[model samples]
Target: MESTHHQFYELFEQLGLPSSEQEICDFIDRHPLPGDVKITQAPFWTEQQAALLKELLKQDADWAVVVDHLNVALHH
Candidate 1:
């Protein structure tokens, strides 16, 4: 099976968010994820955005790596 690699910025875009490098950094700085909270449960995400993240993670989809990257960034 062929898998498509996805970029971090593309995940933001898919979530209907600002996808620019600086914008992504700014967003991460603004929304720090608590150690106990899952990225999909972050209050900053809209219902649809959270659903997408959850679905992607659950399926181990192409966007999963980028989503995991975002999750790590928010936890910092």
Candidate 2:
């Protein structure tokens, strides 16, 4: 199902983030990852946040698709 907002927007909601267009955009701008890092490996996240993201990916839970979309957005 195509999302009404950006895929990353859905991921943020599922992740319990700000979930606003401007906020998510600002977040990405503020926390850019290095060329070799994965979103899950980004340094900005606390251990709990990282674990949550990892769990989403590992479980392929309801939010996995959106999380994967976010991963791509962050990686590139």
Candidate 3:
């Protein structure tokens, strides 16, 4: 479990931040769904996104949405 935590954190660290909303959205659109996906796992990623968003966008729109954009960029 701890390894998984570090892995994800490292993943976010490597991703840095998204340049724009469209970049994020495009990434998300292209991202593939997990084989065993579930909504309950959503919140687990929120914290990571918020953390990255703070580092990247700073005083931008809602952190969650910014993170969503980032996710999009990362996936797509």
RMSD of each: 0.7, 3.7, 12.2
Position 45, candidate 1: lDDT: 91
lDDT of each: 0.94, 0.75, 0.45
lDDT of 1 by residue, 1-76 (tens): 9989999889999999998999999999999989999999999899999999999999998888889999999999
Q: Which lDDT tens digits does candidate 3 get at residues 1-76? A: 2321223233344456453555544545655546354322434446665455456445443444534544554433
Clash count of each predicted structure = 0, 0, 3
- Best of the two (2, 3) by TM-score: 2
| Residues 1-76 of candidate 2: C-alpha lDDT, one tens digit per residue | 7634336777677666898899998887777667788878888887877888999889776677777767766665
RMSD of 1: 0.7
Worst 10 residues of 1 by lDDT: 59-68
lDDT of model 2 at position 58: 94
State which candidate, 2 or 3, has the greater lDDT: 2
| lDDT-sorted candidate list, best first | 1, 2, 3
- Highest-TM-score candidate: 1
